[model samples]
Structures are given as structure tokens and as C-alpha cells.
Target: MKINIQNYESYCLLYIDNELSAAERREFELFMQENSALVNEFNALQQTVLTPETLLFEDKAILYRYDEMEASLPSSFKQSLYREEAKVVDGYFTRTRIIGIASIAAILLLLLGYQFYFSNSINVKNDKENRQTNNKSLKLKSSKDSNNLVRVDANNNLENNTLTKHKSEIAKANGSKLFTSNNLPSLKETDIISQEIKTQDIIIENDVVTNTISSEVTNNLVSDKNAISINNNNSPILNNTNIPSETTENYNTINTDEHDRSIYIANFEIDGDKLRGVTRRINALFKRNKNDKQK
Candidate 1:
């Protein structure tokens, strides 16, 4: 139709968008030529032309304006967010706390172990020194007393004889009474080796319809040469009944029968009446710290 200044902008938009007919387009071009000053406006409107949209927003649900919703932070996050406002949340022994406690316990264990070992060693050393001095004094006294005593018979100086013998026995027996765990073997002489149980698998048929095979286990060490054979009726019989040889040698505990099971600490030696309690523990620990130097 007739293109005016007001409608000319609309015509230019149609032309930029390629929505005008050929006749309308020619008329729009001729109007632009008549108003050469408005050509800049048409050029600006052409720049505003939006290209065809390849990507489209399919979801119309989120586009609708909704009411504001109340938001809440997690308790853990709230505790961190508000320093003074946060109450004492009882997070009973968190992983970090447990780890810290465990670390302290381990340190305490090492400290206690060190104290027990060193203190016991010192006590043992003092006892040994005192014991040696006492033994020497007792020996001197016993010899002199024995030389002076005039025993007419077995009954004469019975008290003196008993005391002398007891003193000598006590001097000779320098070790303290030692106690050790039954399961744990001494490291001094025991050579513990892990042994594997060897096994040989024998195929035994379990078919009920056809040839059914029967298997028998025996304590006999020898296996039959003709272990598998077809019977007269065509059913196979497994005569192999020998148990594995390695199973027999399986031991529940380390065998200390070969030698006397004496408690001996490899690192340090403490001569006393008998090794017992903490001393015996030290003896056991010797096996674990085998590399420790002999002191």
C-alpha cells in the first residue's frame, strides 16, 4: 500500500526479515530511494534483525514467576556460617577426633613400653649387683662357719647344715621365676617356617542316571596305582583314599619339644631368681625386635 514516514519503518523491518512481497519490496526500495536521508535508519533497523533461532527453550514451567520460598542451611554448614549464634552441636567424636585420640593412644603405648622396658632393666641390673655381693658374703660366711662347726653325727648342727645348703642353692639359682605365653615360642632357637598344604584333585562322577562314581577317604599314605577303573557293569569306581601327606605335618603351635623352652631376652640380660612378669614380656618382645643389639 502507501508507505509513509510512520509506516516506512515497518516496511523496512519487513524487507530486512524477507517477509514483503516482490511488489511491496520494490515499492519499499523506491520509497527508500526517494528518502535517501532515511536510508541510515533502514541500515540501523537491518542491523537489529535477529537471525532464525536454531536452539529453543523447550521448558515453559521455569519461565513463570513463582513466589519466594524460605531457604534453610544444613546444620553442619550453619555451624560454620554463624560463629557466635551456633549452639553446641553434639557431634560425638567425629572422624578427626577419633583419629587424634588414636594417635595419642599410640604415642602413650610407645612411651609406656619404653618406660617399662628401661625401668625394669635398671631394677634387674641393681638386683643382680646386690645379689652378687650378697652371694660372695654368704659364701665366705658359710665356708668359715662350716670349718668351725664340729658335727659328731647327721643330727649335730642340723640348723647350720640346712642353712648352708639353702644359702648355696640360692646363690647358684640366680634367675627369677619366669612366665611365658604358651602360644608364643622363644625366638632364640625357633625357626618358624610357613608350610603349604599340597593337594591333588581327583575327578569323581556324581551322575545318578549313568555311571555313578563312589569315593572313599582313608588314612593310608599310599595311593592305588589303579585308582580309577570301570566296573563290570560299566560304572567307574574311585579307589584313591590317601589323604594329603602335608596335612599330617600341620601343627597347631610351634614345637618347642626339641629344646628346653627357656625365656631369654636377646637385647639385654638380667640375672635374677627367675624371669617372670615384665621380664618374661621383655623376653617375648626380643623376638619382635630381633635386630636390636645385645646389651
Candidate 2:
């Protein structure tokens, strides 16, 4: 049979108190023999219950003497003793309170210092970031100004080149013109043939001149198509094609128009492809439907 731990503890207490019957004692000894671990626990309990009293006053006369001496002590002395004890207790509590307050103050100071340090670090980081952002903005602005200056220079160069080309073409056309002299010969067949050939050559030259003039007119038309008037404080009004405009407003407008046209063309092509895809899908669906109907 299994014995409960609580019943064993009760039995051990009863045995220590000498309240167990002989039969119970014999049964307990047999149980202890089966569980040898209980023998040490039983000895420990017995020792605890049978502790020897070393603080007993064996002499009655000494005890009476102590009692008389305590009675003979003055009442003021007893009151002073109690007062000293209260003072000691109060001092101990005061020191403890002081230490607790100091600890709390130190902890608060540490927390404040940490918060100050963290805030300072964040502020420093923000300042640095602001400075960096300002520097980057300045650099970007400078770069943009430089790029504008370079663009202006490039425009001036292009205008100068176009002007030189126009001047050279006009010069070449003037040089190609035939200069006539007032001289005549007696009428003859050779002279007539020569005159015919000269006439044919002059006609050809006139045709060439007309073609060059047409080409020059076409160029002027293209340039005038997107002409822009510039209002510069330092430049005078320029109405002649021999001198091109100093401003890039016309060039910029032409580039913008070209870019917009390119974008429109791309979009148109994309829409056309989408329409073709839709048509193909519709055709495939119709073919499938026809096949299904035939089936």
C-alpha cells in the first residue's frame, strides 16, 4: 500500500511526542526499513525535538540577586534607556531615508543628463543635415547657372556659323553671274552658232541662279516659321536675316515643338498597335464562333 507524505509527517510528529502505540511503532520501523532514506530524516526530527537547554538558570540564588538588582535601578535610568533606544531607531531610519533620497536624486540626474545628451546629438545631426542640404542646393544652383552660360555660348556660335554660310552662298551666286561687254561682229553662220551656244549657256546659268535663289528662299521660310522677338536691354532691334538673333528663344521653341511631335508620334504608334491587337483578338473570336457554329 502507498503511504501519503502528509500521513508520514503526522506519524513522525506523533512518534517524536511519544504518542504512538507499540504496534504503530513496530509498523513504522518496518516502513523505515523498506525506505532507508527515512532513517536519516527520523533521526533529524528526533534531534530537533530533544534539543538540550543550555540557557537554564540552575542557581536560584543568582536569579533572585538579578531580580533585586533590576528592581533597585532608578526609574530615571530605565526611562533614559528607552529614550536612547528610540533615538537609535530614529537615527537608523533617518540615515536610510537620506540614502534612499540621494539614490533617487542621482538616478534622476542621470536620466536628465542622458536626455540632454540625446537631444544635443539629435540637434547636432539636424544642423549638419541642414548645412549639407544648403551646400547641395548652392552647388546645384551654380551648376545650373554654368550650364545656362554654356548654352548661351553654343547658341552664339551656331548663329555665327549660319550667318557665314549664308554670306558665302550669296557670294558664290553673284560670282556665277555672266558679265556682258558692248562688242559686236559682222553677221555670219559661225557667229550665229556661237551666239546660240552663248544663249544656251546663259539660259543654263540663269536656271542655276534661279535654283540657288529658291533654295535661299526656302531656308528663309524655315527660319521665319518659328521666329521669336527678343527684348534684351543691351541689344538693338535686328530686322535683317544677314544677322541672326542673339537669343536662343527661337531655337528652344523649335526644339520643344520637335520633342512634342516625337512624343505624339510615339503615342500614335502605341495606339495603332493596341488597335491592331484588338482587331486580331476580335477576328480570332469571330473565327472561333464560326467554327463552333459549323461544328
Candidate 3:
């Protein structure tokens, strides 16, 4: 599942050179997919390989010269050469050592430079912070004095507003009393209209109650008709096979009240007798109230 350091570097080099076999390429692709850092490192390595200009020319030249020398010599001489000499001849190994040493020296210098630079930066930042704090303290003191004056001004304005509001409220209350006592219209005419409105509202409430009852009856009749149609369409054998007599009795007993109704009864069952009675009553009422019909 995981490639070790040795294999990881080798695989990266292979991937960069496009030398991986199909299976190896697939493995590396999957590895890159799972590891974002690896993918980034692979990309950087590829960029370096593609653009050798970014690398140190001295290191490259040292290695290149070593390569020429090794290539010029026989393979027998290569095996017999001393480690240091062999490395000098094999330009890659020698250049790696040189580069490594150079890199270490560069890193040391960078660290020292960073320490000095960061320390100076920290000192500068501390000085800036101290100056900013001093400026803020002065600003805050000035703002506090201004705020105190503003608060006093605001208090005086608030007191003036409160007094004005109090006087206005008293004036409005006196005006309301004067209007109510002297300028108010007579209630007798309004009383007649209000009584008429109350009577009309009572009649409207009765109409609403009646319409609600009638709507309920109509809904029940529609449900009964639908159930009857469904019953007639289904095979008698299905009813006999699937439903038992006791279950049918229980189904019929189930309430159709909105709050406590079973889904089957609410959906399918209806009070056919009550619906018919209401329909007949409505017809009779309609006939009796013919004089009240809208023209």
C-alpha cells in the first residue's frame, strides 16, 4: 500500500523520465493521487529535469567532466580505481558530494543570515509596536476627553428632549380630551350602523357554519363513491382471499375523525347515511329559502 523512501525516489525518477512500465506507471499514478505532496515533489523534480539551467553549472560541469574521463577509460580501470579517484572519474558521484558540501555551507550561511535578519526585524517590529502603543494611548486619552464632552452634551440634549416630550404628551392628552368632549360626533348614528353590522356578522357566521357542514357532507359522498367504484372494479376473489371478515369489521369500526383517524378509514371510508341525510336536508332548505336567493 505504501512505497518506502528508496522506492519512492526511484519511482519519482522513473516517472520523470517516463521510463516506468505500464503497471509501474499505474502504481505511481495511484500513489500520486493519494499523496499530494508527492505529486508536487514529482512536478518540481520534472521541472528540474526539463530545465537544467536552474541547477548549479559548477556542479554540473564537474560531473560532466568526470563523465568524459570515465567514458574515456576502460571498465577494468573503473573497478580497480580508489573510492575517491573512482568518484572523481564517475562525475555523478563526485558532483553529488561536492554539491552536498556546498549545499551544507550555503544552508549554514542562510541560517546565520536568517538569525541576524529576523532578530533585526523583531527589534524593528517591537519598536514599531511600542510607538503605535504610545500613539494609541495618546489618541485614546484625547478620545476619552472628547467622549466626556460629547456625553455631557448628549445628556443635556436628552434632558431637553425629555422635557419637550413630556410637554408634548401633556398637550396631546389635553387636546384629545378637548376633542372627545367638544368636537366628537354623536354616537346614536354610529350605534344604529354598528348594530346592523353585528346582526349581519351573526348571519354570516351561521352561513359559514352551514357551508362547512355542507362541504363535509359533499367530501364524504365523493369518498363513498370512489370506494364503491374501487370495490366494484376489484375481483371478488381478491377480497375473499386477502381480507378476512373480522378485519373488515375492524376496518368499518375505525374512526374517520381527523385527529384520530386510521389512514384506511380516513382515505377510503365514508358515512353514507349521514351524507344522504345532509343532501336531503340541503335540498329541502334550498326549496324553503327560495325567497332569500340572490337575484
Candidate 4:
């Protein structure tokens, strides 16, 4: 009698048909009052009473069951397809066994095919590599033969003479790079150092003409900070140089001045003396001054 959303529908149908008791009818009336939106639904239920319809099929013969219409296999075909007295069921190959054997045979054939193809590919690659190596050797040999068999005549036409069958080595000025390998030991530290030094002291020009360059040129090259006093004795001679070629009649490039250069140390000036003599006099002066101070 206490109708909810689920049981209210049945209660409403019972109320519509007057099949509900007084208590259920009162509860359903209260439910309908609370849900006034479903009044149309209640009112529409009476019109929804579906009457039994007499339906007629236009193709009534299709619905009829006939003996010939029932599909069935022929006796011989049914006997062939029947598994009841089958030979395979009489302790022979089953469906599972047949399928397993087929899979095993497929795998075996694949393995055998792969092995044959692998072996053939390896053989083909080896044959191709061997052919290439042989062709390269033959080309080198043919080129060498051609170079050695070159005709001596300017027009390269040998009229009567024929080449000797015996192999002969002709000395060629321009030829392929020939490798001359030696079994020398690894270079030591000293050998490496000597090789580097030899490479460092390479002379680009072996012959040089020595011209008499005046002292003015040498003085111009010298800075005031590094001034040098050279007397006429040394003549600016260039030593350790290659001997002048007879073809060039030029003199030595560095030529000393005719007069000696004056040497100045602070206010004191020393002239007309060699460097060694000037150094000795300066030392003697310092010694005398020390002796005087002691006395």
C-alpha cells in the first residue's frame, strides 16, 4: 500500500483497473497528487489497451513445413561425413593429431628451405668476391704487360720485329708507386730527435750571393737599447755559411766600417780600442778606486 517510484506504477495500474483495495487506492491517489506531472500518463493508459490483431502473411506457403523443404545430405554423402563409425575414431589420427602433424611438417619445410637458401647465398657471395679479386689481378697484369710491350718506334708500329716471349723488365722513368718495405726496428728517442733536427735545419736555397753590406745597414738594424760597438778588426765577417759560388762574383753582405765605433758607458767615452781592451780598462779603474779607498 506504501507506493514508491517502482511500485507506484503497479499501484497506478491497479487503481486504473479498480483492482486496488481502499488503502492502496488512497496511497496511489496520494502518490498521483504528489506527482501531478504523471496525470497525463495515468489518463493515457486506458487508451493503450492493445487489442489482438488478426495478421495474414502474403507468402503463407513459405511458412509451411514440407518434407522436401527440409535440407538433408544424401545417404552416401551422410555416410562419408558420419563420425560414428569413422576410421579415424577407430584408434587412428584425430583432428588434434592431424593439425599437429601439419604444423610440424610446415615448420620442417621452412627450416629446410632457409638452410638451402642460406647456403646458396653464401656460395654466391663468395663466388662474386672471388671473381672480383681475380678480375682486379688480371687488369693489373694486363696493364703491366702492355706497358712493357710498348713499341720503341715513334709511331708505335713495329714493321718486322716481334716481341720476345720471355718476360723482360724495362726500366721506366715514370711508373706506378713501388713499395720498398724494410724490416727495420722501431726508432729510438735519439733517432727521432735527430730526424726532427734534420728536418728543422732544412735549407730552401743552397746557394746565396754574398754582397758587401755596409756597417750603416747593420747599425740601422740594431736598436739603441742593444747598441754594439764593433772595431775595424772584425769586419762583420759571416761564418758557417756556404762557400760562395764562382758564378756570383758578389762580396760578403756584411761589411765593417773603416773607423772604429766609439764606446760610451755613462759620461765616460772609450774610442779606438777593441771590446776586450775596453772591458779590461774599466775593470782596472774599478780596482784602483777600491785600493785608494782602502789606503
When summed lDDT is taken over every stretch of 10 residues in candidate 2, the lowest stretch is 176-185
**lDDT tens digits by residue: candidate 3, 106-164:** 55654565456446556655554344333322322222222121111222333333432
> TM-scores for all candidates?
0.21, 0.21, 0.17, 0.22
User: Alpha-carbon error at 137 in model 1, in Å?
Assistant: 0.6
lDDT of 4 by residue, 123-208 (tens): 65555434433332232232232322122222211211111111111111112221111111233445434433432121111000
Q: Report the lDDT tens digits of candidate 1 across residue range 31-109.
A: 9999999999889988887787899788987777655544667799987877565587769897656755665565565
Question: What would the C-alpha RMSD of candidate 4 be, to one decimal place?
Answer: 40.2
Model 2, range 1-295, lDDT digits (tens) per residue? 2334547767777778888888887777777788787778888888887566688678876546565556666888877777433443455557546755665565565456545645655665555434433332232222222212111122333343443344334323434211111111123444334433444343344334434554343233223323211323212222221332222121111132232232122123223344345446655655675687699
* Prediction 3 global C-alpha lDDT: 0.43
Instruction: Assess the local accuracy of residue 68 in candidate 4 as a C-alpha lDDT between 0 and 100.
Output: 75
- In candidate 4, stretches whose alpha carbon ends up further than 4 angstroms from where it belongs are 1-88, 148-295
Query: How much does each candidate deviate from the true structure in C-alpha RMSD?
Result: 32.3, 31.8, 50.7, 40.2
lDDT of 1 at 134: 37
Once model 2 is optimally superposed onto the true structure by TM-score, how far is the C-alpha of residue 225 displaced, in angstroms?
Answer: 46
- In model 4, the clashing pairs are 211-252, 211-253, 213-253
lDDT of each: 0.42, 0.43, 0.43, 0.41
Clashes of each: 10, 0, 0, 3
Among the numbered candidates, top TM-score falls to 4
Q: Considering lDDT, where higher is better, how would the candidates rank from best to worst?
A: 2, 3, 1, 4
lDDT of the structure predicted as candidate 4: 0.41
The TM-score between candidate 4 and the true structure equals 0.22
Q: C-alpha displacement of 6 in model 3, angstroms?
A: 99
